[model samples]
Each structure stands twice: as structure tokens, then as C-alpha cells.
Target chain A: MIYMKRVRLFLVLGLIGLIPIMISGCLGSKTSIQALFTVSPDKQVIPFTANFDGTLSYDEAGRIVSYTWNFGDGTTGQGPVVAHMYKRNGAYKVKLTVIDSRGRTSVSSITVQALNPPPTAQFSYSPKSKLNDKYVVGASEWITFDASKSTDDGTIVSYNWNFGDDTVGTGKIVKHRYIWPGTYNVVLTVTDNNGGKTSYTQQVNILGGPPCNSDISGGDTTINGSQK
Target chain B: MKGLAAVVVLVVLMQVSAIAGGVGLFAGAGPGGAALGEINQAITLYNRLLDNFNHTPTITGNVPPIPKMGSGITYQAGEQFWITDDLALGGKIEYFRTSVATAGEYQSGGKKTPISIALDCSTIGFVLTSGFNFLHYGFTLGVHGGVGYYYSGFTSNITFSVPSGYNKTISVHPHTGKGHYNNRSLGLEVGLSMVYPVTTWLALGVDASYRALTAPRLVDAHGIGLDLDGDGTAEHINLSGISLQVNVSIKLDLFR
Candidate 1:
């Protein structure tokens, strides 16, 4: 039994001696093939193009035969230098793998961040059409305001309007009219989900359309094109 | 601002009456350098917006480089009254302006946005000066110090874009019209000058002045501070800077 234990210890020592040789063979030489790359503008807003260059990679024992890229967005490419545009916003881990002529491969990775852009503000108003380059609307008439023309990459949380007459309203589509006949500045302010705010202002002229009996319009006046 | 300047003029004019000897009119202009204070804080505001995505911002396309406020131009017009041949007292109105206009891009990891910005600042000072003219042969060497009221104006047309999560672009403040911010503060200045004798009535002079001025508060027409860094407090304005100017002075021996 003691002789068998000595034999087992000898085998363990031999295994330890062989481990380094196996690792050395796998590790290659001091100038072993390395997959090194650089990414320009790795961080950007969505719909952004990034440039990747793997020319800095080197293989001392053999020529590098292949350069493969995994953009982490479920896309792949093959080249020494390539440009990729991120269509969506997210964190992407880009990988570059270089294979030498000897079939040895090395991999490097970098994290790319694509950010979201802000929403643009736009809107169109009806019964407030342009006449001779002027926005004209009849006073005390139904003027429909629409913000559907406004766009956002995400969701627009709120649409606020300042009717320039100390009256305010909210929604994607609203109706407002001036009480007195004059030129009024209509302002539409939109807020996106990201808390970004944008405003659009249009100067609209309100016509009295000759003298209207003020006695008949009293208390029955429709300032917002709605009967009070 | 005008009210305070008028009061200061009365106080200085009384002092001039006490020691009237001779009078000289001077007008000068030159390059200047100053601190931008809240005006530059707009860039910090821009960076903070970009940093929201947890990505480092790489800004490209700016003049004078970012974070380095800028250089400016100064014009001064004033009159000095000689209390004696070597001693004189003066009052001058000086104006200084600096401008910055940039259309650039901010890039983070893989995304980018465009930005267009314009900012111009002006400072007007009404000051009282005391000078000791030491030399008067080929060149006149003198040193002077002054105290005054400085009115600062900041005009901004700053516009920066951000991305909506939905793949659209929007302006942070589309209603951010051209806003003019104004502030006023008391100022202290000291300067040295050397004048070359061009003629009996005209002398060409070069002046180097250091002004120390700070406005504790700056506000817009709506009484709102131009707080760009998300900080509720408005950034103070610093008009302190060095100005080197070339001047032409007409000296007359009056009531001598």
C-alpha cells in the first residue's frame, strides 16, 4: 500500500511539470498575435456612425488572415477598418477578433453607447390660415389648433398653449379664439418624455369684421369657439 | 444704471472744482481680456445635457476652444484735469465687448448632435482717475488708479440640440430668443501709461490697465438669472481683466 501511495505522488508531480509546457505552447511567443483595435466616437446619439480600425493588431509568427467584427447589435462584419452606424440607442459591446495564418485567434472588445435625440416641435392651426403672408382669424370664431405636425422620437407628454390673452390650454389638439379684435401671438409649447421643452409662436391677426353688436355677444361670447 | 452714474459724476465733479489747474481730453482703444463668468456657464449646461446618457462628450467646432471664455476690444473716452503739473484727476467712460459664435457637434460613444451658439458681452464703465505724470521729455510716464460704476450686458443667442429617445432631434429651448442680461457693479482699476510727444497739442500714448470688477447679480428682462448649469443661483459676472490701449490725448493749459 505505501509503494502504491509513492507511485501516485510521482504521477501528480509529472502532471504539474507538463502543465507549463502545454500553456506555453498555447500562449505562443512574446510577440504572439494580438487583436487590438480603436473606435472613434464610440459614444454618440442614435443614428450615429462610428469608425473601427484594427490595423494596430499584429502577429509575429504569421500573417493575420482575417478580421471579424461583432457589433453586439446582432450584426457582423469582416475588415481591417469598418464603419458602422447605430440605428438605435443602447449600450453595445463591439468585438474584434483577429485570426493569424497559424489559425491562432485573439479577441478585443469595446463598449459603445448610443444616446437618444430630443424631439422637434411643430404645429399647424386651422381657420388661422395665411392670407397675403399673414395669419388671419376672425375674432370670437372657432380656431382649431393641431400639434399633430410636431414630432418626437419618443412620446410627447404634454402640449401646452398660451393664447396670448392670459388664457392657457393643454392637449395635442385644442381650440382657442381671441375676445378682442387685434393681433395676438399664439404660442404652442411641447414637452417630451425626457423633460425636453420646445415652443413655437405664430402671430395671428384677429379681424373684427365690421362693428358687431356687443350687447348680443355679452356673456354668450365664445372666446374658445365654444358657447359659454 | 444711468441714475448711479449721474450721481457719481456729481461727486467727482465737486472734487475737480476744488483743484482745477488744466484740462486734457483723451480717447483710446485696444485689445482686452476678461473673465466670462455666467456667459461661459452655458457650455457647462451643454455638457450636462450630453452627460445625461452616461457617455463622455467630445465637442468639436468651437472658437477660442471651449471653457476659455475669450478676448475682447475696449474703447475709452475721458477728460483729465491737472490739479498740478505732475498731478491730475480724470473721469472716463470705457466700453468693452467680447463675442463668441460657434456651430459645432457633440459626440458621445456612437451618437452625435449639432449645436449653434452666439454670445456677445459688453461692459460700460464711468470712472474717476487720479494720475501722477512723472516724466515729460521724449515720452511721458504716468501711473493712475480709478474707481467707477460698471454696467455689463450679456446678449445670447444660444441654441443646442438633443435627441429624443424616438430617433428625432429637438431643441432644448426653442423659445430661447435673443436674451439680453444686464448687471451693474462698482469697479476699481489701476493703470500705467507712456506718452510720446507727437505735437504741442497732441500726444500718442500707450496705456495698460487692470480692472477689478464683479457683479453679484445678473438678470434678464424678466428678472430671471441666466442659470445654465441647472443651478438655481445665477452665475456672477466678472469684468476684471487687463487692457492695453493706444490713445491720442489733446492737452490744453486752461485756467493756468
Candidate 2:
């Protein structure tokens, strides 16, 4: 009888212990809150704006009543979502804190990177004319390539040109003379101080002048030992 | 007086019979006669991460242009309690992640510089669902709906070679950073599942779900701002899509 009584006592104590655990598991839902969030376009070129949303933050058993944001730039905001713009290039840390209806809070954070914008490539050539007239040019004719129309956010430092006739030059405006008439390709490459570069290519046709000995060679050009 | 006493006794007996019937109904109700409770773990083949990063530009050949987001994977675990034969209430936790890389060259002043870019993203959250078992035969068909939280973000890294005209070569270092965002606007999810029971307690299932949430804005740790749409204001990232999952579930008969 005593052994049976001890077993019953142990069972009652075990059940009492389990009662608290079960109740806590079901009723303590709001005790742990997870503060979560996301940032769009996290990496960007300078003069950038970023958007922040904390709608994904959650309370385990309750509802989130408020959201607070710290932009890491000495700026703060209150809401479930917010937006900020960075004017310069650098790295910044953003943070979000969410409070549940039960006064429990959770925090989340991320890093944002902003870099200087790369130079844009834009250029125009002078003498806006087509090489369609027989696609021909006189021998020893001079052709000009002007890359002054190219633009960059920063100053353009240099221009390199390949005349496609075993010739190269350096300048914003370059002139090349083709001695033997043929089709030639002209290429221009522009570079900025930041090492940014862009290139453009144009085709030119240079027609060879009439052969100097066209008439003398056809009929009777023969050596003393050999005749045709 | 004798008739009143007899009527009272009859009413008492009827009440006892009704109570006994209610207890019998509760005892007989089970989850399709297989079990009264279940726990499931699933592996998800998710393609939605690709939609989230589709607009960010990356290095490609000679140009830096935007590329499509890549596919990803997720895992989830859930528990359900059947209150009756056909209806159940449950909750789940899900985790997802993805990563992608791009490389290209930037050319200028007759010189070419190599550039590389990479992105990594992850998410973790929970949801509560109400499910209905609509069909039962060789296989069981169930449908569910829920509201939950979705926490996600990405880390981006960019490296570029030093340009010409610098007296000293500046060592190229990768610029890496993370942006965190969240959606709390009552995220909604709907799913359909078909399960084939191998035994009384174990089942294999295929589940397809569609989830929708408010678009979250990405903000870097540095608190930098971005005007993605050029409207002079900041914009949010879109992180909504569908998921296909394969799951294994085990039924527990403790309640029954």
C-alpha cells in the first residue's frame, strides 16, 4: 500500500509540473518578439535613395503596435515603413526596432553601400556626311576624327585614336592621311581621370588614284631576251 | 404530485444521455481515422528570390547591366492539431537563402579593367494556418490559408580594377554590404497539398503555396538612401512569389 501511495504522489507532482509548461507554451506567445526587416537596392551609385519596410517584424503571440527606425546618419523615423536618400558615397548602417502591443521590443539592422557613379559614354563626330558616293576617296586625302562631343561627369583626360593604317595618334581632334586608297577603319577611345573609358569606330573609304603606268605596260613591254 | 415526480426523473435521464452522446462524438472524431495530430518538415523549391533581385545591375561583358535573380531553396517545419475529422489548426517556420555572381570588363582609354559583382539573400519567418482536409481515399487532399511575417535581406559585393593614370596601383578590394528589410502588413499565404499515407502514422506529400506581402524597402547598414525608380523618393523591393514543397509528415495519436 505504501509503494502504491508513493507512485501516486510522484504522478501527481509530475502532472503539476507539466501543467505550468503547457500553460506557458500556449499563453506566453508574446514573450519573444523578433524584429525583422528588409532594404531594397541596398547597393547603389551615389545620390541614392533607399526604402525601408518593417512590416515583416512580428510578435510571437501579439501584434506589433509601433516601428522605429534609425538611419545611422543621425536621422530617425517612426512607422512600419520609411525611405531615405544618401547624397554621398560611403557605407551606412540602418536599424529598425519594433514594439509589440505587450510592450516587448525587437531590433534588426543591415548595412548599405553607396559608390560614385561611373562616367557615361557619349560622343559625336564632325562633317556629318556619309561615304556612300561610290564609297571612294582621293589618294593622300586627309580625314578628321573629332571626339569633342564625348561627355563625362568628370573631366575627360585623354583620347587615343587608331587610324587602321598602321598609324595611331593621341588627341581630342586627330587628322590622318591615307596615301593608298582603300577602305580604312578609324577608332577613337576616350578616358577619364577615374580610369573610365569608352570607344567609337567609323569606316572610311579612300580610292586609289589612276595608275601612273596603266598605258605603258599593256601592249609591248618586253625585255631584250624575252617577248610576249 | 406523482406525475410531476415522474416527469422530473425522465428529464434527468435525458440530460445524462445527451452528455454521454457528446463525449462519444468527441472520442470518435479523428484526423481521417489515421491520427489526431501531426508534425511535418518540408523542403521547398522556391524561385521567388530571382524576382526580388532582377532589377539590380551587374557587370556583363563591356557593359554594367541588370540581370535576373536566381532560384533558391527553403526549409519549413510545422505542427497541426485536428479539432474534428476535417479541420485543423497549425503554425510553421520557414527559412530560405540564395546567392549569385557576375563578372565583366570596363574599357576606356585603350585600357580594360575587370569588375565583379555578387549578391546573397536570406529569409526567416513564421505563420499560422487553418487547414481543411477535403478528400480522403488512397490519397488525402488538403487546403490551407494563413497570415505571417517574412524577414529577408541581401548582401552585395562589388570589386573593380584600378584605372589608368594613377601613379601607384591602388589594390582592388571588394566592397561588401548588407541591406535588411521586412514585411509586416499581414502577409497572406494559401496552399494546396496532396498526401499519400504509407502507414497509419507516416505520409508523403507535395504542397504548393502562394504567398503575398507588402513590398519591403531595402536599406543598407550604413543608412544610405536610394531612388530606384527616379521619382526623387525611395522605393521598396518586391519579394513575393510561389513555392513548391515536398514534405514528410508524422501523426501523433496522443490526443485520440
Off by over 4 Å in 2: A1-228, B1-67, B107-112, B159-185, B225-232
RMSD of 2: 21.8
For candidate 1, lDDT tens digit of each residue in A36-122? Answer: 666777788789998887876666569999999999899999999999999988889998989998899977787888876766777
| Per-candidate iRMSD | 25.5, 16.7
Q: Which stretches of model 1 miss by more than 4 angstroms? A: A1-228, B1-19, B41-67, B104-114, B164-177
Candidate 2 chain A lDDT trough over 10 residues, lowest sum: A218-227
Candidate 1 chain A lowest-lDDT run of ten: A219-228
Clashes of 2: 36
Give per-residue CA lDDT, model 2, range B1-256, as digits (tens).
Answer: 6597468546644553433211111011011000000000000001111121222133123424324343566567877655445555556776666555666654445666565656555566576665666689899997766666677665555443433322221111213233343333345566677778878777788777655543355555555532221223333433344567788887665444
What fraction of the true interface contacts does model 1 reproduce?
0.00
